[model samples]
Target: LRADIYPTLESPSATDWADRMALPVASIMWTPVASVTPDTDIRRVAQVLLDTRLPGLPVVDDNGLLTGFVSRTDILRAVANDPPLDVWG
Candidate 1:
């Protein structure tokens, strides 16, 4: 199937290069994105990371505020030096 592949924080590797060549570009593509607010719960944020496979999510607060962003690395740090918890659930 043809689809747009956006690069994440990490650099694209050889596998990614191969995929880009193998797949054809689709005429139209729609990807649903999930955003988080400042008040959003950490559990939910972790869930989003697992579900979306996105490196990060934009953090938009209520009152139309743009506070900052959150990434997988940020979550890793939160879990201390140990491995991150199972976010799959």
Candidate 2:
């Protein structure tokens, strides 16, 4: 939905907040949005993000409600924080 929201986010000239707010949510929202579960593998999550070309994805529960978000930066940070393996040892 980020792409859908992007067009309405900024304009060439100043925009009226009231006008933007009045627009129907359906008109601006994307359909069939993808999401992942809490138990989803990190590798699968990475693949989904790459395929969707999104900065992040929603983390949903079994009931299909959003619990949190997982982002590219979050994955990168996890990798960066891990101690490097002693391959030569």
On lDDT, the candidate that comes out on top is 2
**Which lDDT values do the candidates have, in the order given?**
0.71, 0.79
Ten contiguous residues minimizing lDDT sum, candidate 1: 1-10
The residue-level lDDT of candidate 2 at 5 comes to 55
lDDT for 5 (candidate 1): 57
- In model 1, residue pairs whose N, Cα or C atoms come closer than 3 Å (at least 3 residues apart or on different chains), thus clashing, are none
Give the number of the best model, judged by TM-score.
2
Off by over 4 Å in 2: 1-11, 16-21, 83-89
Instruction: Indicate the residue-level lDDT of 10 in model 2.
Output: 50
Model 1 spans with C-alpha error above 4 angstroms = 1-32, 81-89
